[model samples]
Target: MEDAVGYRLRRAQLAVFQQFNEAFAAKDLRPTDFAVLLLLSCNQGLKQSEVAEALGIQRANFVAIVDGLEEKGLVERRKSEKDRRVQALYTTRAGSDYLKELMPIWAEHEERLIARLGGTRERDQLIHLLKRLCD
Candidate 1:
């Protein structure tokens, strides 16, 4: 009787995000940074604007993120061959190696969380339903 669907949903989301934050802290990475790295690795030669759109981040916010990653030398911003005005983003060699090292930890973190949440089926269903809400 006390459970409100909206409130419970928000709480669950926060809890999951918090856990991810904690896990990434071990490698001195923010959740957003990890996501950015993964995105670049998966989609090489994506433009900054494309990354922003794919990640659902505002252009203004993404600028700072790109700056930070570039400063760290984990990402490179190169002028596009086709468009001098546009820059494309790519992960550096160091970034790819760093991601490989953290990949196992990331997998374990996901497994632990899913196990705590009643295992793979429930976790997948939860993610699917959340995506449905956006659609």
Candidate 2:
């Protein structure tokens, strides 16, 4: 009675992300925000275009993400020293601290994902196959 593939997959995806959303709610951060912060922490002073490219997000859509991060006081965009017209993005001190606090929870979430899907290899293959379907 409950075997529709679309329903199952959508529910599974929502369940996984809902766990993440709950874990980071205290910091008022979304998964994408956590990703952006982590990326900036590792690749300090990256350009917005580079972030957009890495995330596979279009420039227009990325504006909303940037605005959210800025409003949360998690990141700042500044004029690039070499190219005044280009803006470089950097995570703020609060962002770094928030990431530090959430790192363990993120790790646990990854473990839960693997457990839910059997194992990492199985999950990876599932994702690869799903991606091909989209293609």
Candidate 3:
């Protein structure tokens, strides 16, 4: 069981998420919340469906996530001028500022993980392998 790749990956994911939860506990953010804010920050004006698809989130589940962020003032949905039927997502100014504050914490978290994985070379290799698996 210890040698099984899937089991190992699941365990690693749990540990990483546990660390993440601890680090962001004060801010009351979850991994998925951070991901949505980050994505909106990078790509403004993306339709809800587009964002959901890109994040590999189901539309139904994605709506509740967006609603929560919206209530928190971290994200906003705007009617697309080009398509009235579609709603585009954007990170609020507060969201951008929040991300700026979170950046250092995020960096520290990543550095810790990278160090645990034996530095940049190993980190890069891990990412590459992970990407291959994802693809």
Candidate 4:
């Protein structure tokens, strides 16, 4: 069981998430929150459905996530110019500034993980392999 790929992956994920939660505890951000915020910051005015689909998150769950961000004043939903019925997601100025602050913390988190994986080369290789699995 210790040598099994699935077991190893689960263990690694748990450890990574623990570190992530600890690092962002003060900010009250989670992995999913970071992912959603990062995506919105990069590509503004994306529809809720589009963002949910892109993130592989279910519609129902995605709504809650967006709501939380909205409450945090980091995200906003605006009526899409192209479609009056559809709402698009966007990051506020505060959200963008928040991301800038988070970048260093995120980098440190990745650095710690990379160090554990042995280095940049190993990290890249692992990322490649992980992408292959995901695809």
lDDT of each: 0.90, 0.87, 0.94, 0.94
- Model 3: per-residue Cα lDDT over 1-135, one tens digit each: 989989999999999999999999999999999999888888999999999999999999999999999999989999998999999999999989999999899999999999999999999999998899898
Distance (Å) between predicted and true CA of 15, model 3? 0.5
Clashing pairs in 3: none
Off by over 4 Å in 3: none
Stretches of candidate 4 off by over 4 Å are none
For model 2, the superposed segments whose C-alpha errors exceed 4 Å read: 1-11, 127-135
Cα lDDT tens digits, model 2, 26-119, are: 7677888788888999998889999989987899988899999889888999999889999999989987887799899899888888898899
What does the lDDT read for residue 79 in candidate 4?
Answer: 99
Residue 5, model 2, lDDT:
76
Worst 10 residues of 4 by lDDT: 20-29
Q: For candidate 4, lDDT tens digit of each residue in 91-123?
A: 999989999999889999999999999999999
For model 4, how big is the CA root-mean-square deviation?
1.0
Candidate 2 local Cα displacement, residue 129, angstroms: 3.8
lDDT of the structure predicted as candidate 3: 0.94
Per-residue alpha-carbon lDDT of candidate 1 for residues 1-135, written as tens digits (9 for 90 to 100): 249878888887799788887877768888788899999999888999999999899999999999999999999999988898999999999999999987987998899888998999999998999899889
- lDDT for predicted candidate 1 compared with the true structure: 0.90
What is the Å distance of residue 79 in model 2 from its true position? 1.2
Model 1 lDDT-worst window of ten: 1-10
Residues forming the 10-long window of minimal summed lDDT in candidate 2: 23-32
